[model samples]
Target: MKKSVKILLIVLAIIAVIAFPIIGTYNNLVSLEQKVDAAQSNIDTQLQRRSDLIPNLVSTVKGYATQEKDIFTDIANARSKLAGASNVSDQATADGELSNALSRLLVVVEKYPDLKSNENFKDLSIQLEGTENRIAIARQDYNTAVTNYNTKRRRFPSNIVSSLLGFEEKPLYKASAGAQEVPKVDFTK
Candidate 1:
């Protein structure tokens, strides 16, 4: 073989070795980002399902406890906030508020034995519970995806590819400030 041809082959081989991993890293980042996006969409879907169920639940509860106007109003405002949310952060905040309002409403329900026994209210409560479980699962999935992607994005070679492609760290769904505290029950109401 000619020396020039041998040298050309060596250069091409070197380029291939470097290019292959770069391409793989880029593709991997893309896949991770897509997974994150899909996970976020799942969360949104669950949130929408919960949002859709709220009005029915509220109306059913209202029929039994007409005097609990404040709790009902809080739920409505939280629903409005969630509906108006345009991004993940806003949705998370709104969702937390809705959950808090729902908790208070549930506490109110405890005072009314009739509402607890009503078939429609019971069914709506079950649905809300199911939707809450789904939302939790979706949030977990999203956080997992974000963690994986962020880990990859911060690593050496992959980080280079990630930065070059403008991939940024995604925000995790954090619990609300007051989420850990148990609701104070007022039996006098």
Candidate 2:
């Protein structure tokens, strides 16, 4: 082999050795980021399913508790806010509000034995409960994905590749303030 040709081959081999690992790191980051995105979409899907069930549940309750206008209005407003939420933080806050409203509505339902016994109300309640469970699972999956992606992007070698490739850390879905407090339902009014 000629001397220049051997030098050229050595240089090319060195470039490949360095480039391959960087390319692999970039692809892994892309895959992790995609998992986070998919998890987020799953949460959205479950939330939408719960949202769709709300109106039917509300209507069934309305038939039995026509005098409880304020509770219904609160639920409607909360549902609207949840539907309008555009991001993780906004969705968390809105979800908390809706949960509070739903709790109050459930409290009011206790006053109407007939509404509780109605088939439509019972079915809707069961479906809503299932949907809430799904949402919780989805949130867990999303946070796990975010944690994996963030940890990978922050690690030593991957950190260099991530920063160079503009892979920003993803935010985990957190509960809103006051989420742990039980909603107050005033029955005296």
Candidate 3:
């Protein structure tokens, strides 16, 4: 090959070598982003399940604890706030509110033996607890996926591509203060 032609060939090979990993990283980032989205969807579904369970649980308790109107109203308000949440931060804050409401509601149930022993309330509480556990798992998975995506996007060469393509870092799905660990159930319901 002639000198200029050989130089062009070498340059093309170098460019191709550099391009490969960038493409791979970008693809991996996209996959991670999708995983995060799926994880978020899982969490949302679980939270919705818990939301649905709450009204039934509250009504069941209401039959036994008629005077505890404030706690029920608080739960209703928290549920409304959670349903209105639009983003991770809002969701986290609203989840805290809901958890607080639930804690109070459960405390009231603890005092009412009939409410705690009710079959329907027991079943709903168990389902709600299971759903909450699923939500916690999903949030952890989402955070892990976000970490991987953010690492790729913020790294040297991938960062260049990410910046050019507007791949912003995703926020981690953080649990609320009370939600750091699953709630402990004492009296079944």
TM-score of each: 0.93, 0.96, 0.86
Candidate 1 differs from the real structure by a C-alpha RMSD in angstroms, to one decimal, of: 1.6
TM-score of 3: 0.86
lDDT of 2 at 115: 90
Report backbone clashes per prediction. Answer: 0, 0, 0
lDDT string for model 3 (97-123, tens) is 788779777877878788788899899
Top TM-score prediction, candidate number = 2
Predicted candidate 2 versus true structure: per-residue lDDT over 1-189, tens digit per residue: 699999999999999999999999999999999999999999999989988999999999999988888989998898898889989989988988888888889999999999999999999999999998999999999999999999999998999999999999898998889999999988877
- The models' CA-based lDDT, in order, is 0.91, 0.93, 0.83
Model 1, 1-189: lDDT tens per residue?
699999999999999999999999999999999999999999989999999999999999888888888888988998899889887888888888899989988999988999999999999999999999999999999999999999999999998888888999998888767777786645565
In model 1, residue pairs whose N, Cα or C atoms come closer than 3 Å (at least 3 residues apart or on different chains), thus clashing, are none
TM-score of 1: 0.93
In model 1, the Cα lDDT at residue 184 comes to: 62
